[model samples]
Target: MKKYIIILSSVIIIIALGGIYMKHQYDERQEKNKTAESELYEKAKKRMTDYINANYEGIDKINFSNNYKMDQMGGINAEGYLNGDKSKEFWGIYDKSNNIITSSYVDAKEKPACKEKPCKY
Candidate 1:
């Protein structure tokens, strides 16, 4: 009876330790993913802002939609309104090569057809 209790206790301890280790690993991965996502968002914002600054003059308010999508090719598409004007919608794409593919300000009432590959949002 004593030997059986000792074996059972050891097995329980091992399982508890394994569970703890797994939980710790999962937390670490989540943190790392969060950091990576933050970095990506910042980079996308900066590149989009740069594009706006270079093209549009005397514009201050740049509001980005909290909803951004990542393409299968590791590119990001960010959409927003220009100067807080709902009518003036902007869509920017950040490619994998750190290149700003397109930044377009379109009339919110009508979204033009996407003719080319990787068309507007």
Candidate 2:
């Protein structure tokens, strides 16, 4: 009976340790995802700002939306609307791997352009 009790106790302790380890790993993963999201958001925001500033002179407060889509591979797609003309909007894709604007296109037509200014999306 004593031997059985010792084995049971060991099993319980191991299970507890495993649970704690799993929880810690999950938390770490979540933190990493959050960090990545924020980084992507900032990059997308900048892409929009640069586009508006270049396309239209003296346009400071163009409407910018947070990253609308985030891929597991750290790719992001977002849209920005011209402040003066809400109907005019552009979208851009940010590739986190190279930390650069992969593509941009206007809403009216999907013209993929590599230019950083005048976002192509």
Candidate 3:
């Protein structure tokens, strides 16, 4: 009886260790995925900025009109002056140039506009 009890305890201990090891492996994989996603977003943001600078010259104070999601791609509509016109509108992709180059325009739910403080238009 004592020998059988000892064997059962040893088996339980081994199973527990195996479970812990699997849990650690799962956590590590999730961390790696998160890191990769973060890097991708950083790259996307930089690409978007560079494209805007190269294509849209003489435009300043550019702001994102909509919330950016990491899981999906979208576009942002910007309102700014071009050569002091103060009436030009720019609609382009969030982090890609293909949409802009192909002339794909996405309707922005909330358009960004220049505003002054104290309710001044």
Highest TM-score scorer: 1
Residue range with the least summed lDDT across 10 consecutive positions in model 2:
108-117
Which residue pairs collide in model 2, if any?
A: 91-121, 104-120, 104-121, 105-120, 105-121
Each candidate's lDDT (Cα)?
Answer: 0.71, 0.69, 0.47
TM-score result, candidate 2? 0.67
lDDT of 3 by residue, 21-117 (tens): 9999999999997776556545544544444454444545444333334424443333222333434444433334343322222222222331121
RMSD of 2: 4.9
lDDT of 2: 0.69
| Most accurate candidate by lDDT | 1
Q: Compose the digit string of candidate 2's lDDT tens values, residues 17-59.
A: 9999999999999999888788778877786566545444444
Let me know the TM-score candidate 3 reaches against the reference structure: 0.52
Estimate TM-scores for all models: 0.73, 0.67, 0.52
For 36-67, candidate 1 gives per-residue lDDT tens digits of 76678778888777766555545668888888
For residue 2, give model 1's deviation from the true position in Å: 2.3
Higher-TM-score candidate of 2 and 3: 2
